[model samples]
Target: MAQTATRHAKLWFAGQAENWALAAYEIDELHEGMEDAGKYHPTHKQIKQAIPELIAQYVDQPLTALEQAINAKNKAEFIANYDKLTAGCNACHQATEFGFNVVQRPSFNPFANQAF
Candidate 1:
């Protein structure tokens, strides 16, 4: 059951990676899905390690920090953080032995002028 839930979480993470602006609720649901899968599993453990930034981004005030980064006009730093998040996705895929299944990185963010 844990592994099944983990698989589902992986799916959510994959979709989230593909389009983060789809819905903010998806993020916490993904995290909760991962947590519900158990902490002992490798992917869950990796998620435990990887969630701080996510928490920061969603719960721990990631958007404000993003605003600060943007305010500073530091596209590089933003990209670095975005890359860090992507690395987490890669880390989990690698740990799950699906390393060949490279997760797609975000391209052309869909948040600029679209109605949510």
Candidate 2:
């Protein structure tokens, strides 16, 4: 889950850099991550099963919008949906009693060796 969230943040960074191609690639990766999570991420499966409504509303829906914006290469809509995605993540955390682990649009690259 942390890894997926980190990748999501990186997607945001790529979008912020106006690197739409990179952002699109990362969006694909993020979607794949979610798919893998559904299959293999135990906690993800648990929460998703327990709170289908929240997951659908916050996580799935926002990610679908993000994907659409990325596919369209609409910078403005992409930015808007990125914010939605961030809120969705935090909303999930809060719903699951992990609100202290606040996810934000990262201010710096957490990857020390990678350039954004």
True-structure Cα RMSD, model 1: 9.1
* True-structure lDDT of candidate 1: 0.43
Task: Report lDDT per candidate.
Answer: 0.43, 0.78
TM-score between model 1 and native: 0.38
TM-score on alpha carbons, each prediction: 0.38, 0.80
Report the lDDT tens digits of candidate 1 across residue range 2-115. 443343344333343443333234335544554544444433333544444333343224333333443454555444544454455555556545477554443444344533
Count of backbone collisions in candidate 2? 0
Best by lDDT: 2
Predicted structure 2, TM vs. truth? 0.80
Off by over 4 Å in 1: 1-23, 39-79, 107-115
- Model 2: weakest 10-residue lDDT segment is 41-50
Candidate No. with top TM-score: 2
How do the residues 1-116 of candidate 2 rate in per-residue lDDT, one tens digit apiece? 77787788789888877788888888888877766655664354335444445556678888889888877878899889988888888987888777898887787787777676
